[model samples]
Target: MTSKEKIISFPHMGNYYIAIEFLIKHTLNMKILTPPPITKKTLELGSKYSPDFVCVPFKYNLGNYIEALEKGANFLVQAGGGCRFGYYGEIQEQILRDLGYDFEFISILNAEDMNPFSVYGIFKKLNQKLSFTKFTYYFALTLKIAEIIDKIEEYIRENIGFEVKEGSFEQLQKDFLNRLKTVKGFRDIDKIYKKYNILFRNIEINKPKNPIKVGVVGELYVVMEPFSNYFIEKELAKKGIQITRFITVTYLFKNHPKEKELIKFSGKYLKYAIGADGTDSVARTKQLAEAGYDGVIHVKPFGCTPEVNAMPMLQNISNDYKMPVLYFSFDSQTSETGIKTRLEAFYDMLLMKREKQKWKKVI
Candidate 1:
């Protein structure tokens, strides 16, 4: 609200804020307010204002916008476009207006059209002090940082389950992400990521050469946001299951080029994109089955039409390949205890199946 100070805010989606914060700071020199980490309170706020049947991501994001507005953020950013999210910005803006909040709502919904110059234009319009040359430099660095963070996270997912010391990998991940926030440029990013990658590798773990691997396939938001999925990955890891997921912050930067391969792989099941990550889900589940993974876990929000459409195809894949698949649809009202019990049953089944396979090979 102050004449000289402008605060821009966006919803939380894992550690993605770290790179976003670096970009806004180094390029536009604007103050950034991050919505609080998603919690039970956040879900409640979002659910109360949102349509009862909207996907879970909508409620969570609406809650984020409300809380950010309450905390004095004048500019709200909604950076999603795939699926119904493309239409959510205007709807959320209207809802907030109805509630009497006066502010600017910015949408970067057309992610495919985004480029360095377009991004520079957005910030330059907000503040004339943003230099095109400086923005270019920082933009490239910001992308590298995003990719590095994703890579480090993937490493952590693969190893965290078997750490010799409890919280060892987690503590390293925490330190690394916090340090990432203070890094000024590419050199700092490279140095910090390398140091942490080394530390993560050196951390003692008792992983079997071939471990139970579960590939997570779903709508990107539900798969990537821990709150939305009830921290399923952490629970699976605690049971010593290695996890693989294709969605990440960097997937946006790459424009999901892997989608071409996904189409080819899923052609027998689905010939065209069903929207969002539907095709990718089918393709990834098939890929995991072919690659000898123990199982596949599909996570999506309730009323997710694309994922719903893909479910039949996934069931076909499950039947043909004899690959075990677990499907989870989450909303604000989803019960944590129910999810925990179901996961336990699935893990037990997979363990027994593996043991049977081993016995058959020996016989």
Candidate 2:
């Protein structure tokens, strides 16, 4: 089938649309269709059809598949790990079939046969008409774009709280995305990034006297997609809290090996991998605690198993390290106001803890 006849869909993860844009630009006749950003309705739909105890990412992605099918998407692409997620494609496909949706589904990562070549083969199938040379060229460019996007997002998360002007970082981010769309080559990408790097660096920032730092972890989908989580980071930044989220596409795709090393470093504490993202969540929570972060926010979809398994361990880490951690489960009926209130309370508790630490040091 030609690229135009295929529609690629993945769960709402960080900057996936950016990655999709890179794919479309490189492949001829390809049209991309992303599921609408996850919301209360998404969770409701997902929960309605999914097994009650299924992982949250499963429900979310299932909901996405259903929604995309309803919206004329004919091809679904599932990319993830060697755990239950590796098998999600089969289950989700069957569910879609039962729902009477006619579509083609591709699972990119096959646990038993996973290799670089296997991965490249999937990409080749997705764009069968593209020459190998062209595929290599576009893949390289996409990696570069992913790196730049990750760096920019990390910078924003770390510094957005200090912006002297409200929405300055967001506005600049919008401008950066617009500029990125105009980039046609490596040189153009570098030029745009360098210009914006300097522009953002020069912006005056007022460091909060006692900044509340929150480390976010959980099911990859909700944590990575701002829209999926109702812009939770933005709301925290607006409250003048510095936010640190450990999940990024660059880390997941490019630095998975290094992360694997870190997981090994966790050793016996994280003995069994509950699922795809469970191991990473445990390691990240520990790292954040060791880094002296004030608090951690764990966001998961309603039925996510890996994160559910990680939560008890996370609580143990929080207690041992004397750090605060908040857990939030998102679904269609979850109230935004409730989330905001919890965040406000978490922020207040962190600030008070910092004050106590200061007084203790003074004494």
Candidate 3:
């Protein structure tokens, strides 16, 4: 079939879809069928069709697939990972097939299969016209885009809460993403990032000498997908809470430490890799506690075993260092009100704790 006849779609994970879509359109030259931005209906559609015990990411993916298929997507893609996520494509494909959908599914996953060379192989099969040199150039550009996005966002999370003009940081970020949509080459992305880096730093802020800081660590999917976690970072930013989170598309691709490095970084709290992103969660929480952050927030889908395995280590690290830890488990039925209430209380407690520390130094 012609590239135009093969419309491709993948699930959304925050703004990273911009980068994913960039790579696909340039390499495969296929029609991109971006799923509708996720909403309550997407969650409901996914939940109704999903098995009772699967993780929430599975439900969300299933939902995205159904929506895309209904909208004339003949080609769908899902990424595989170390956890139950590795089986997502197989099961989700079967479920959609049984539902009477006609489509082809692809799992773009594997340690050996993610880099430009392997990815080029995957695309070459779909688009015979794709050349090695051209594919590599665009792939590199895509990674650069993802890296710049994460770096700017890290700055935004740290200062968006303190912007003198509300929404200035967010508006600039929106502008940057819009600019990214128009990028044609490496130089284009570099110029856009440099322009925005200065624009972001120029935005005024009223940050305190010692601001309340919190580190967020969690399951990979929930940590990256805002809708799944009910926009937790945005809600916290509203309280002027400077945030730090270690997981991003950038980190997964470029900075994810080796297993040995992660265990060593975790110190006495962990001796082995728990599973998937869980080990990274424990290690990062310890790093945050040692750095004297006010607290750490751990978010995961309900019944995620790897994260469940990391909790005991997290608690021990919390106790030994006297750092507070807030945990959140997400599912289709999770209560938004409860999340807000807990976050409010968590912010309050962090404020009180910071005050107590200040008083101790005074004496």
Candidate 4:
């Protein structure tokens, strides 16, 4: 550890930084050095330095670390798990070192299972004042806040497309996020969650009672990170499509262990786990198809092995169940215009299919 004050940093993942900043500021009494929001520059920087074949997340995170390092970050903390993500921190650390950037890299659960003591040990190393009691309190509060935020976002995804006023949901969501940054404790988080929940639920939307529901199933990072997927959910919502995404940090912690059931559901199509979220993707796609969703969108980073393996299985599921599935592979080179055009075509096809079915019923 350096004798000077440490500036800590981590890559951005949606609004996760809000909870993370709160935990660090309150528990460790340390100043957080957050990276700037991911942008085209971030992507360009990441792609410039990253291996051509590596996943897009590596490029994005590396870019984040470089930007933070430039901003005087002395310590970099990264949280990753499942498949290749387990090795990202070590690789990124080595890459930065090769580039002559001096920084301490801390990785949480890269390969090992989640253990509170291990995490506490990392914090203790960072700040001697940190203890299990304080860690537990702050960690629990962060978890609650994360869950609440995810739930709020779920509501936003459902209503954002059909908002009576174009930016009604977005404006309120911006206000909620701004308020979130100033929150200090559990009471503040809980109060804000409730306040925004009501506010979002009350926002006027012109959605049909039987709106087209689309299920999004795919690799976790690509699905969770909006910029990674080019904000596909928001784009869909803009087309008056309701999206159901079952993946969240809460689901990752609470239900990931019972993935045996997902495996069972997917076993007929996929005999083995392809690692990461492949099995879950197959099972969720089948579940959504059987549950009568109008369509399904499969998203993943280009060159991701697990999602690539799931593609054929998804095709089989789509054919067997007679469902429409749209696939998008994202990389730094993926053009927004291409994505928008594809999504427009997919939406029109789904709308036509729905109308044809309705006509059949009328006959």
By lDDT, the best candidate is: 3
Candidate 1 lDDT, 105-189, residue by residue in tens: 8876456547887777787887788778888898888889889999999998887999999999888888898999889878998
TM-score per candidate, chains pooled: 0.96, 0.86, 0.97, 0.96
Model 4: what TM-score?
0.96
lDDT of 4: 0.86
* Higher-scoring candidate on TM-score, 2 or 3: 3
Residue 351's lDDT in candidate 2: 80
Q: Model 3 off-target regions past 4 Å? A: 1-4
**lDDT preference between candidates 1 and 3, better one:** 3
TM-score of 1: 0.96
Output candidate 4 Cα RMSD: 1.6
Better of 1 and 3 by TM-score: 3
In candidate 3, list every pair of residues with a backbone clash. Answer: none
Model 3's alpha-carbon lDDT is 0.91
User: Per-residue lDDT for 1 in model 4?
Assistant: 51
- Report residue 114 deviation for candidate 4 (angstroms): 3.0
What are the per-residue Cα lDDT tens digits for candidate 3 across 1-363? 233488999988888889989999888967999999999888998999999899999999889989998999989988677798887788899999999888888887655478877787788888999999999988988998899899899999999999999889989999999999898998898899889999999999999988889999999989999999999999999999999999998899899999999999998888888889999999999999989899999999999999999999999999999999999999999999999999999999998988898899999
lDDT of 2 at 213: 82
Q: Which candidate has the top score in TM-score? A: 3
Candidate 1, residue 232: the lDDT equals 95
Q: lDDT winner between 1 and 2, please give it.
A: 1
